[model samples]
Target: MEAQVFQALLVFVYTDTWPEVEQEDEPAMSQHLLVAADRYGLERLKLMCEDKLISHIDSNSVATLVSLAHTSSVPK
Candidate 1:
């Protein structure tokens, strides 16, 4: 689990998927990083994950997202 998270973080940190080519991000990717962020005291990374999760939230996923946020000890 930690290995996968580390790999994803590697991609996120090193790759420059941008205006010309957007990143093919997985929904759970940011969530995984959120855990690592908390564990390692990566504040900027945590904020980035929070922002990503916020943008992905919607009516259909609100309940699940809220639950995940609570589980992660994130502020609502």
Candidate 2:
């Protein structure tokens, strides 16, 4: 369940389909980072996204996250 949620959030973050409006339930891309951070225990990834990563992470970040979740050295 967590992984699924994480994937969904990742897609939301790394896609142009993201909505412009900021709402409580509808978080900004940064919020997805926070979710990933919490679920995967990726503090650095979260901070990087919060600080300098998200802006640079292209649309492919979602696919990267999916791939990472499937097979990567990173512990999740």
Candidate 3:
């Protein structure tokens, strides 16, 4: 499987949420999880990813994250 898919499965198998996983500043990993969650219509999973993303928010990257959120159709 592709890396993104593998990462999503890892999120499910390893932790209750993506933030709980120890990826450590891996925004790409989190992004993958968010996309997978959205694609699968897993609202809980998507929210978990969104919450995690919010937790990591910093001024410098906030715009990028917001852009990602918009592009991904993440909820407010």
Q: TM-score per candidate, in order? A: 0.64, 0.30, 0.66
Pairs clashing within candidate 2:
none
Please tell me which model should have the higher TM-score, number 1 or number 3.
3
- Expressed as tens digits, the lDDT of each residue in 3-37 for candidate 1 is 76787666656662211212445457777788777
Task: Quantify how close model 3 is to the true structure by its C-alpha RMSD in Å.
Answer: 3.2
Question: Model 3, 23-75: lDDT tens per residue?
Answer: 67466566677777777677787777676777777887788887777877676
Provide backbone clash counts, one per model.
0, 0, 0
> By descending TM-score, how would the candidates be arranged?
3, 1, 2
- Go through the candidates in order and give the C-alpha RMSD of each one to the true structure: 4.1, 11.8, 3.2
Weakest lDDT window of 10 consecutive positions for candidate 1: 16-25
The per-residue C-alpha lDDT of model 2 at residue 74 equals 38
Displacement of residue 53 (Cα, Å) in model 3 is: 1.2
- Which is the leading candidate under lDDT? 3
lDDT of each: 0.67, 0.50, 0.69
- Looking at model 2, residue 42 earns an lDDT score of 59
